[model samples]
Target: MTPIERKLRIFVVEDEALVAMLMEDILLDLGHEVSAIASRLHQACEIAQAGAFDLAILDVNLDGKPSYPIAKTLRERGIPFAFATGYGGMGLEQPFTDVPTLAKPYVSEDVQRLIMGLMPSIP
Candidate 1:
């Protein structure tokens, strides 16, 4: 018998509205629900502080602002997250270098693979 996959509640922080929408669609297709989406650093930080999520996909840069604050909040909350950046992992600072990252223009499989690595039971 096939094991039932867990449906994770995910938080997404992307400054680009279209990118966020695409990610939402992709997450839904992957059988996960997007608990919340924030496009600004302050708003994302607020959501990170107040919301509960299994995981988060954070854009390293939100407009002209950095997403490190939100990442910090998630870290304190014990939530796992991966960075999504157009500039690749090189864009991240030393402190965040060890975190997983997804390069921009990622496909559904890319996201699935990353999340599966983070949560083995996801697939």
Candidate 2:
């Protein structure tokens, strides 16, 4: 696709360090910038509310809680994001029911596809 021009700022919130790192690497490789990375629901909410990201990839669960609050903030600010989870379709919360998502263990191409799907006009 467009390869995400100009290092599009992205926020990645996943509790698993390895998965978060993998996502960060993928985003960087795609020529996008990782504005911030959070591994907890609270941290994700705070960062999302701070308004620094062009987009986000949020895991459905962070620590022991759902990332719904962060999702709410993203929606409130009109920030586009996709849920990333091992649980796939059944993992999404009510408010994020229709939002785009990526299943865990995703390949780089999977990330690219989801990003493209979320921002189709970008390419």
List model 1 lDDT by residue over 4-119, tens digit each: 26889999999999999999998988888999999998899989999978899999999988899998888888788999998989779968888899889998888888787678
What residue pairs are clashing in model 2? none
User: Which digits, one per residue and each the tens of the lDDT, describe model 2 over residues 2-121?
Assistant: 556355788999998989899999988888889999997777888999968788998888887988888889888888888988888775768678988898889899998887777753
Best by TM-score: 1
Clashing residue pair totals per candidate (backbone < 3 A) = 0, 0
- Cα lDDT over the full model 2: 0.83
lDDT of 1: 0.87
Q: Scored by CA lDDT, what does every candidate get?
A: 0.87, 0.83
Candidate 2 displacement at residue 78 in angstroms: 0.4
